[model samples]
Target: MLPSLAFLIVSCNLQPVSAAGTDVVSCVFPFVFDGRSYSSCTKDGAIDEQLWCGTTSNYDEDGQWKHCSLQEHGGSSGGQPCIFPFVYKNQTYYTCTEEENRGFWCATTRNYDRDHKWSYCADIRLDANPKGPCVFPFIYNQTSYSSCTTDGMSNKKPWCSLTNNYDIDLQWTYCEPSGGKRKRRCEGRWGPFDTPV
Candidate 1:
């Protein structure tokens, strides 16, 4: 049997830290899953699992070895979802719902239209497995779309659809940083992209 895994909820246990000049409550715990350690869920695959956090497994005779991001143990049960920082085609992705939260959910892109349902990663389908740091799709200008990993802010212009396969007018929105008017190119098929202007 492998080591027992546990899900540590930081909100349940808070620690006090000084930030700026005021005391702030924080809960930052090292995630240890089945003897594998993870600091944050950021990198792709298991070996690079240490990208956000470090994890090791002794399942093999080689002692504690880092597995691929997707192969790492994340949920409490083998059938449960894997943790964040999973890899797909060598790119590290995060699946958590909130942009700031990091864990197994980052491995797959959540279904933004489906009540925060995480059912796809890099366009691939996932059933019940939720562990992620998954790649998300880029939908722009109501008609352009692409994957976040593939699009780049080239020529100071937003990355547009590279293929004719994507249809414009699907649903596009402009994204601007909070309190700023400069819009950055971003994509999502069915949502409003807004910034505090």
Candidate 2:
């Protein structure tokens, strides 16, 4: 399985028809679906098992969508969504990364060098996955969250901390439901994560 990126065919020339007739063609990165923010395409709520993405930033609110590919994965499980072709450190990233000891992370924007926006993929495993350093069962509100939670933020996006105890470290990032870690800087005043476009 690929990490971060929602794999798409290299030559995709789809002409999706919209009822509203709005002229937005390109897919919106890190869009919202079912209240969870996504940085890539997903099949979570697909009609026929095809990977699809919202045309606008919020599918729940806008209901605009288009096909990504023709029913790839044969109905396999869906994971966190990530935007592809994102730039980081002068390099382009098409999949998730474990750089800097951060967990499976993906740039939340098209240019990480400018925005510095990113998030960790979400994993529901009982124990921390051996792949990276993201601490599982992190504490929030004195309650342990083995997976990402939307309760901590106003946007209701999924997020988790780097340490086993968010109460102490306070380092965390919004998480993708696709697989598993995007640690935001954990310190000082709490602020909202910038929207990924």
Candidate 3:
């Protein structure tokens, strides 16, 4: 009888560590993120889809495992760096790292003048390169345009028009100087008017 009692004591002491504590429910898919392991299966009668091992102190409560809230344990993809040459408002923009440290930002080529359109440069992970082209405004034929590609005056002709109202087609006619007096010969400049001749 004493030997049987000693054997029972040894058997109880030799129980598995997990058996001594709470039992974990089997999960089909498990994933780890942000130093936390999560299972894609929920506990019995649990409304939530995923279950976190850290939710419960013993990972089980009254034979029911705790489920993780979608709001609390949902994975986040925020805080990602930005990419360069992105188009905003129909214009291409590039990132500048030098100005990033100074609290400056990245903006589209057209938005370089506007202060509000710029976004945090560091968020886009821009690389510092002094030689990189920076957007600058240029005047051509009494019109203002912004460009980061050309260093100096571009060889391309400015989209000059006779009137301010112009479209993408840029359909306009060029007129030659009349030397202060209307030409006697009708050469495309004259319109229907009462003449004293």
1 or 2, greater by TM-score: 2
Candidates 1 and 3, the one with greater TM-score: 1
Q: Where does the lowest 10-residue lDDT sum fall in candidate 3?
A: 183-192
Candidate 1, 125-190: lDDT as tens digits: 222222222223434333334333223333232332322322432322223222335323332222
Colliding residue pairs in candidate 3:
82-124
Error of 3 at 59 (Å): 50
User: What TM-score does prediction 3 earn?
Assistant: 0.19
Q: Which of the two candidates, 2 or 3, achieves a greater lDDT against the reference?
A: 2
Worst 10 residues of 2 by lDDT: 123-132
Q: Write model 3 residue lDDT over 47-135, tens digit each, in one string.
A: 23223322222222212222322221111112123334334444333333233243323452334434233333321131111112222
How would the candidate models be sorted by lDDT, starting from the highest? 2, 1, 3
lDDT of 3 at 101: 44
Model 3, which residues run further than 4 Å from truth? Answer: 1-78, 85-93, 97-128, 131-133, 139-145, 148-197
